[model samples]
Every structure is written in structure tokens, then in C-alpha cells.
Target: MTSRVLIAVTHLLGVGHLARAAALARGLAAAGNEVTLISGGAPAPLVAMDGVRLVQLPPVHIVGTAFSALLGSDGAPAGDTIMEERRRLMMEAVAGLRPDVVITELFPFGRRVLADEFLALAGAARALVPRAAILSSVRDVLVVPSKPGRLEEAHARLLALYDGVLVHGDAAVLPLERSWPVAAEIAPLLHYTGYIDDRPVTPAGEGADGAGEIVVSGGGSAASLPLFRAALGAARSVAGHRWRLLVGRGVPEEAFAALAGEAPAHMTVERARADFPALLARAALSVSQAGYNTVIDIVRARVRAVVVPFEAGRETEQRLRAESLAEAGVWPFAVVPEAGLSAQALAQAVTQTLARPLPPGAAIDRDGVAASVALVACFAQARCRRFPALSRALDEVAAGGGSVALWWRDDDAVAPTPALDRLLSLAAKHALPVAIAAIPAHATQALADRLAGEPLASVLVHGLSHANHAPEGEKKAEFGPHRPLAALCKDAAEGLRRAGETFGAPLLPVFVPPWNRVSDDLAAQLAACGFAGLSAAGKATRPDARRARGLAIAHTHIDPIDWHGGGGLLPLAEIDDRAALAVRARAAAGGEIVLGLLTHHLAQDEATWAFCDDLLAFLLDHPAVVRADARRLFREAGEEEAWCAA
Candidate 1:
């Protein structure tokens, strides 16, 4: 089942938040979801975002490391009008998508600057009838807030609005409590999806591992000037190794040009390259900030490295992550604290990292994309009970060494009406098989031609004329008690002949009477007409109808519409309750059974369409469901003597 997801990301300094969120969006979309990503940061030209619908909001960034002043697109403090506009656009996007999951990047734990917008989005999601899952998407480490009561405030808001917190790092490598003090308070809602790095693991070329080249990268943030200055001095001192310094695009052009001008004969300075990961794979030593994306890339490259934790203002996220990696001994990493960092200290740390042998590998869980998708799927399943019920039924049956069959029967379908076309389209969308019970008398060659175009649409013989002979109509029935046996048998035979002529062999030999009502005499007449199955609405469980006179009986247990009430759809809760009972009945059945779903295309409304979409997706999402036709069901029944005997 493909669900709609809305992910919001606000990156103030670096592209790390937006990049990681984009990775998650790609993962979810690759798993067959319709994803909408709302980003409030400046766009990165090099970062490729595919498979998701992107909504770029008005850009904003922090004023230096203050984290308090918000700068607008013109590089001045954003006025109240700009802030209000951003919030309004953000709210409108959420309301329009009406997504199944609302993922906010670094909210509650970080991104406090945009809390008003995020909280408004969350409130809008809650107000939806079928509310979305409000989730907090945070990185491995959090910048411990220095303000008193800030942790409590974040925790309280999380408890009030968020359903879960997806920590995108392996807890075995660095747990949440190592940096965030209130992790324990939200432990119940915490889920670790490993690290979100989807870079390929192509090993460096033959002689690349021993290249003895030094690689230096400052992350994509304006905060890398100090690191670039120190690295330039270190390049002058490091004698043997060839040095390459990459100033990211986030750094100003003037600073980049200054670093380029100061490059020594033994060094190369340029902008960041797309092959940075490739460079790390071959380098003898790597020096970079302890940003989330970079650290993961370094680990994936498997090179000896030194990290300079960016510690401006109250930002301790990078420093904590760097120290955690060193403490775990995962990589041969030499950490140089940004505070009072000097060129001499950086040069020595680079030398020390180069001298140490690389560890075998880290045991951290790096399956973040897949794990996170699975978790969201489970969360969606839990919220939608129909899926879990259907899943449980399939699992229980499979575990008991039984198989399940499913088929759809659309009653009163004679021609290619718009409603019938929509029903067939829905069936086609899910790859489900649907039997159109066509009234043989009304079945035209045009209808048959239209149906022949659809591979999943099959024809079943509805009763002759579809007219009721039930005296003043106690209820509508084509083969009711008031009808004579001889008349009914003759009509049934004529119906069979008409169906054979109209649909030929493509039409299955199944009889579906109008109003799903049939007599024993009509049942007996089926075999003489060469019918293999009799389908109708029956009890909640299988064998709702029995094998009658050598004809297999398959009844539909699910009908979403309330035909008696102006042809409207039933309440979702009522429909789910009925489905749950059927599932429970199937689980308790002693033998394999086929579950039939009944539908009336002409009588459907919008609510019916929505219900059918969700229900069919849920059923098809399960592995044990085998779409069946009347012929296959009869054949399977013949193969299993138990079905015949029962």
C-alpha cells in the first residue's frame, strides 16, 4: 500500500538536516510511498532529491552562531511579516497533503527557532479526521541546551504532540542519553533507526588505499573559516604527504579565495568535490568536522581520521559525537577541540591519526533507511486496524499450514458505466481480481468488448432479466421462493446460453443471482448449465454456503455499502468490525477457505470508494492473499477433498 507522507525540515546553518531528511524521504518513496518534503533552508544544487514532491519555503538562516536572530533572503533580520508568511505556508502545506505521517526534522530536540511553525503544523495534523502520525526526526547527538527548564519544556511538548521520536543513529554506538538529558523521559516513544547514510560501498581503486594523500574538509557551513586557516598552516608543516583542502560551498567565496591564495607548493585547495567519499576511501588521513553526514561517510570509507568538533555558542552536538566515537574505539580518530585550536595542535593530531592503524570496522547498525521505513509501516498498520486484522488472519492461517484465497464480486454489473470503470480501475491499481456478475439478458457485445480489455476483470453470469417476481416484494430476489422451479430453471438455462454467447470461454461458469438469493432448485440447475461455482452474500465465515449438488459455493463476507440507506457507504468502524469478525472466523476455521468481497459498482459513493481503496490495499499488503477466480477456486476445492466433504 502506498501511503502519503509529509516531512518538514529547517536547516539554519549546514545542509546536514536537509540532506538527512531527503535521504529518509527517498527511502520512504522507494518503498512505494507518495512523499512530500517541505524544506525551509537554502537549496543545495549538488544534493540530488528524487522520488519526493519538494515544497521549498521562504529561506531563513541564523545570524552568526547566536541561534537567536533569523536572517531573511536579503541577509537582514527577518521581519514579522516574513515569519508569519512562512508559518502560514507551512500550515497550508500540511493541511493540503493530509498525510499519514508528519515527520519534522530536529524538532523538540533541536530547531527551537521554528517551534511556532512546527507546533502549528502539528496542531493542524491533529485536527484532521484521520490524524497523521506526528514524529520527531533527530540526529544521533543533540546540542545540550544551556537554558534552565528548556529540557523540560521540550519534553512536555513532545509528550503532548509527538507520537514517536526517530533517532537516526545506532544506539549501540551512541545512545540518546549521552547528550540529551531528557532522553529517559521520552524513552517510551524513542526508536533508533541506525544511521541514514545511503552512499555506495565501492572500494577505492587498486593502489588507492596506500596513496598517502591527506584530505581536509570543512562541513557545508560558514563556521569553517577557523578550520580552513588552521589546515593551511598544517599543510605547510606536513612534509611528506600531499595535502588537499576542500572548502565547502557554504563558506564565502572570499574566504575560499583567500585559502586558495595561501596554498603552498605541496598543497591543493579547492571547493568540495562530489568524489569526497571516494577521496576518503583512498586517503591515508582524513580531517573534517564531526557533522552527522560526514562522520557516517568517513566510517563507510574506512579510513583513519581526525575530527575537529565545531563548538560555537552552545553547540555541543558535534563535540559529543566526536568524543563518543573516540571513546567507542570504532575508528582511529584523533579529536581536536575547536576551542583554542591551533595549527600546531591540528598538525600533530593529523600525524597521530596517520600513524595509528585503522580498526577492523564498527559494529554500528547502518540500516537506517530500511529500518525507519519498516517502523513507519508498522506504525501505519497499528493506526489502521483493518491492516493488522488482515495481516493477523493471513499469518495465523499460514502458520497453521493453510492457504487463503480472495476474490471480488461486483453485483449488477452489465456494461461499462463510469462507476463500473472506476471499480475496474481500482482493481487494476491493486492488481486484484474482480468478477463482474453481469445480468445475462442485459449483457451486450459492447460490454463484453470493454471487459475483454482488462486482464483482471472476469465475467460471471447474473440471473436472467434481474427482475424480481416476489409478489408485492417482501424483499428483492430473482430466484426467490415465489418463483416456480420450472420457470426459474428455464431462465437459468437461457441465462447460461446468453452468457456463453456474449463472453465465450473467457466468462467463468459461475452463477450469481440478483440480491444474492437463490433456491435449492436453482442450485441444482447449475450443474446442468455447466456452472462450476455459485457466489452470493452469506455468513461472516467461509462455507457460508455449502457445496450444493456438485457446485462449489463461495459467498462474499464483506460489503461496504448500506444499500437500504439511500445507497450510502457504511461507517468505517462498522465495516472494520465486520471484517475483524470474518478474520477471526477464518483463523479458527479447520481448513483452507476462500474469502470473497462483495461490491456494487453502480451504487457506490465517495465514502465507498475511499473505504474500498484502504481495504484493498490492506488485503493486498498481506503475503498470504492469493487472488482467485471462480475456476481456480473450484479447481482448488476439487484438489482438497476436505473442502468438498465439508
Candidate 2:
């Protein structure tokens, strides 16, 4: 259950992306997973990195709002050398860790400039022996691209390479569709994980350092320099109030010193504080840009605030967030547009915000860190629900110079239906063979024609008429003991004859009993009736006696349908438990054991179909599991001579 997770995040302007990724890494690590966070941004001293493996690449950041151009650590254009080093380090981490899950933060959504490295990392993940689940991590809101086809390109890349996208905000509060144009196209893969607020809550009056003071912050970047300068001028005008300005580290030393020097006697300007959230707890009013993390802190503090969103260089993420929250009345704030922001406007907004009473705390989801951690963990495991256990067992078998054989069987096939098409498509998709049990009385030539095109599909006779012959008090079965021996044997021979006539070349000489139940006398006569093999549910019983009578047994061990309970698909955990037990038993027996997956195509719902598709693809992709078709399985079961003769 302990998965190894690798999170890749790069921040070009602000540290919000890195900060969110770090929080996620910590949450996963706390859940007993091995977490490695690779950051490709300028390091921020305030971001927590406890209980995580931190990998820093040659960092590159953009100056001001010039996102098209990247600057190296020396503040010059990032040349080929730095970009190459970054890509090399990224691929190295992916190769070295061989993670079970790879989370690319904001790629294929907002980081088109760094597509080369992200695409390469995704390719490496796909090439792993057991492929890693690739996921995209994005904030609640995004900057909608104005250029033609950019959104389409992101959508295409997501469909091609990603398994899921974690939207870190609650849909009820703010859905991705509010900002993303193609949200509907990728809706199936989006998981809304509340909001990622990991800051510890501090009680009111606890923040003595900022009690009754005006707090101003611009997040952890120099992009907030305009906001700081505006707030400085506003502080001089707004008298009789203690003011605190927190300058981010990304601001140049001279810029920070200038703000501090120009502060009035009532104001204090310093570097961004680690306890900003704590400061907000007691501050009378908060003045800051409407970044995701900042808004979360303000919401937790329940403080009346003024928001000056950073809208430079066509940046609309913060502006959209501020407007949405304000419109919903979720957080008490007044927005001061950055276009015409000045000392007078900021002072008026700050005074108005302080005048309003604190709005009652809105009931919104704020458990996003924990929710995201649980979601990612489940996403990683669910990508291959039963595969890890089966893979491990197969690994041990291979280590001991053994191997595993797997076969697929779907019952209740009468004619060519959409369900049958889906089953056949799954088989062809993985190039794995499937044994379809068709009722001979109802089997049609159309079904045979369909199978002719699908070489991997073969037909097995599923009883004479698939009509229950058992007494009403007992379980339903077609070939139960209530029937006479001669009558049952005659029906068996007739069923095989009908199946052979219907499906000439694709027919396998196998008997599949309805409800997997047949009388002992009837089972004993299958080989004599030219069955060559008996297919049933559960493990093969009386193998020696059947083999002496020249009848091979290939029993299906896994069934995903809950026929006895509601007739819907069983929970994935139950199916995985069954599979784990089967695989472990096979490994312990120390031989090439064939594990069969049983399904009912006609009875399958969307959930069942999806599960079967994933299961089949996983078994086919595994290196140690051999896909055994019906003919091959029966031949391996000591019916080679019978198959050859037929």
C-alpha cells in the first residue's frame, strides 16, 4: 500500500506552485508513502520540506511578467546549457526513483514553455517496467489562453499522456469550467480536491506581533512590487493605524530597502514572514493580492481584507479568483484593480474594508491537503487495483524460474450485441485472447461472422439451452442431477454439434456449464461426448479423475460481477482481494498456473466494462504473465492430442 510518488513542479514567477506541491508531498509522506519532490524554481526559505526528499534543479525564473523569456540564477537569458541541465536532472530523478506515480504540477495546462522537459518525463514514466500513473496537478483557476488552438493543444496532450487531473479547489465554490474552455472535454478525468490549505489555525488574539495592525503581502515573488509601493504610499496617507508590509524575497535587496526606508513612523516593512497566516489571525485588516495561498490564509483568519490582484502581462488567474470569491460573498474583501491602483485608491479600499464587520465564515471545503493526499493515493492504487499484488507474485515466480499463464472468459453470449462488441474490442485492444461461452441453441451465424474478423476470439459451448433444470428449491443449473444421464449426455453432444456448426474454425471443443454447476454423472460424460475440456467457475476439482477420462479442466478464479447481490459490479477492493488470493496461491504451488478472469458481457454496466478493460490491459502489459488463449490453455491442460485431432 506504500507507493513511491514523485512530484515535479516548476514556478516561473511565484512560489505558490512549489508550495502547493510541497504540501502534497508532505501529506503523502504522512500517509506512509515514499515521497520525492523535485522543485525547478528559486528556493523559498518559508516553504516547508519536512519528511520529503527534495531535488533541486538548475533553477530558472522569469522577470516581471515576461513569461515568454526565462532568466537563469545570474539574471541573464537562460541559455541552452541551463535548460539542458534542468531536463537532465528531471529525467535522472524519474529514472532513479522509478516511482509508482508521477505528478506533473501545472504542465499541459499553464506551462507550455517548458513542454520539452515535461513530455520527456512523461515518456520515461511510460517506459518503466510497471508503468507509473501520470497525473496533472493544477489550481482551482487558470489563465485562459487567447491564442487559437492553444487550449486544443493542451487538451490533446492531456488525453495522450495523463491519467487524471487534480483540481485543487471545490467545484461548488469555483469549477474549472469557469476559467478553462475545454473543461467539459476532460471532465471525466478531473478530480476536485477542495482547496489545499495546510496552514495551521491560530486562535484570535494569538498573533500579538500583528494585533490591530494593517497587514500587506504580495505572495513570495517580486511581481508584487507594485502592490508594495502602492501600500507604502497608502500607509503614509492612512494615519493612526499600525501598518506592516511584508516584502517577498524575490524582490531585489535595493527595492526592499527602499520600501523599508520610506515607511512612516506608524509602518514597519520587512521580509515576508513565515507566520503570515498567524499574523492575519489578529490583524485588523489584510491588504494583499488574491493569490490562491493568500486567499486561503485570509479565509482561515476570517479577516476583512482588500484584494489588489496582480493582473500584469495578461495574467488573469488572481483577478478571476478575486472576482469569483467576491461575487459568491464567500470571503469579505474589496477588489482594487491593479490597472489604476494608487495611494488614494488603496487607502480608500482599505478604510472601507476595515469599516465592514467580519462576515460570518462561509461554509466551504478547506480540507484540500488531506483530500488531495487521499485522492492521489487512491488514484495511484486504482490505476492498477489488483496489479501490484499480482505483479509481486509473478515477480517471485519469475525469480524462482517459473511463470504465470492467464486467460479471459466471458459467459452469456448468444448473438452479436453491443456488449459482445465491447468485449471483443477489449480483447483486440490488448491483443489478448478471449473464450466466449455462447449458448448453442441461440448461437447465430452473425456471431460466427463477427468472430471471423476477430482472430483472438473463440467460442465455447455454454450448455445445451442454458435453461435451468434444477428443482425450484435448489440453485439454478442447466446440467443438474435432476436430469437423466442419457438425456444430459445427449444434450451435451447436441450442444457441441450446434456450436461446431455455428462457429466452424473459431469453435473450441470445451463445455462451459451454466451457473458453473453440473451433476457429477454429467460432468463425467463430457469427455466421452467429445468436449475435450470442461470450463467452470472456481478451482478445478477432481483433476486426476478428469485427466484419466481425457477431459482438461480450466476453471475461472476471478469474477467481477455480483450476480447474487444486485447484479452490479462488485467493489474493486473485493475483486482485488480475490485476485490477490488466487495469485498468491498459484505462486505458492510452484508451477505455471493459469488464472482465469470470468465476466458476463451482457450483464456488464459501464463500471464493469471499465474495470474489465483495465484488468485485461494490465495482465497483457505485465512481463511475467503469459496470455493463454482457449486452445493454448486446453492444450497445456493435457488435451493437445484431442485439440490436434479436432
lDDT of 2 by residue, 584-603 (tens): 66566444567888999899
lDDT tens string, model 1, 606-645?
A: 5567567667765665666677776566544443222221
> Against the correct fold, how does model 2 do in TM-score?
0.65
- TM-score for all predictions? 0.60, 0.65
Best candidate, lDDT-wise? 2
lDDT of 1 at 382: 59
| All-Cα superposition RMSD per candidate | 14.9, 10.9
Worst ten in a row by lDDT for model 1? 637-646
lDDT for predicted candidate 2 compared with the true structure: 0.82
- Candidate 1 local distance difference test against the native: 0.79
